[model samples]
Target: MMSSSPESRIASLGLTLPSGATPLANYVPYRKSGHLVFVSGQLPKEVKEDGSAFFHQGKLGESCTVEEGQAAAKACGLNMIAQVDKLKRPAEVISRR
Candidate 1:
């Protein structure tokens, strides 16, 4: 049996993983203990070619529409995935809080 690599799986989905982000505070982005890994919260952000961040900024119920909020949520998930993928291990996400 042939196993698919994580990167190859991502590419097969027609999605490119975004670059990993630096922690905004004085804490580490993730902590790995034993076989469990805890990742910090990530926003819907993208680093541009010029190194500027592009993200949606607004309250979900106030300024953003439902569709926009959904998009932002998807972006946030992608960002979190990117962070986990940086660990260079196969990640099976169990749940999202």
Candidate 2:
């Protein structure tokens, strides 16, 4: 039977889960188990035309508004998608697993 969870589907596709980006201080980035993925504690990432994600740290509710904070989160998501799209090919990574 197929898994009802999207994470299972991602794993079925042969993509290894990415471990959470743990911070040296008290911050965290993401987490994973088997084929599941989780992301948290991310600032807005500035992506240049060349597809580079830069962390732009600005305090929300102080330096920016709630809307701005949401935009930053969306930007971070876009950056990750861009990074994934840059992979050579599914056959390359998937086959290796």
Candidate 3:
């Protein structure tokens, strides 16, 4: 069978890509040089269904459990993906799970 596309997989997992985050400082979200696209570091920020922003806070080892930290990392990754989507390049950007 043919594998599903990334967007299909993400939707099947009930994951909605949040809007691209605004830079807190003087920096762009990503930069593309030739075939290589360099994405900046993303925070664990997300937009809730009610259009409110959410992010994980506190020190990981001191105030949060390992599992919580992992969740936060996943949020960060999602934010990064959202930024990449903003590039508007109609190509396969995600290569792995």
Whole-model Cα lDDT of every candidate shown, in order = 0.78, 0.50, 0.80
Task: Give the per-residue lDDT digits (tens) of candidate 2, residues 24-97.
Answer: 57643544445544444433556555856566567998988888888676665544443343333322212111
Clashing pairs in 3: none
Backbone clashes in model 1: 0
Q: Across residues 1-97, which tens digit of lDDT does each residue of candidate 3 receive?
A: 8899667888899988877888888898988877767777588876777988888888989998898898898898788888887776646464433
Q: Which scores higher on TM-score, 1 or 2?
A: 1
Each prediction's number of clashing residue pairs: 0, 1, 0
State which candidate has the highest TM-score. Answer: 3
1 or 3: which has the higher TM-score? 3
Give lDDT: candidate 2, residue 14: 66
Candidate 3 error regions (>4 Å): 88-97
Model 2 residue 97 distance off true place after TM-score fit, in angstroms: 29
True lDDT of residue 33, candidate 2? 44
* lDDT (Cα, tens digit) per residue for candidate 1, span 1-97: 7899877988898877887777778987777877777888678876678978789879888998888888787778788888888775745666654
TM-score of 3: 0.78
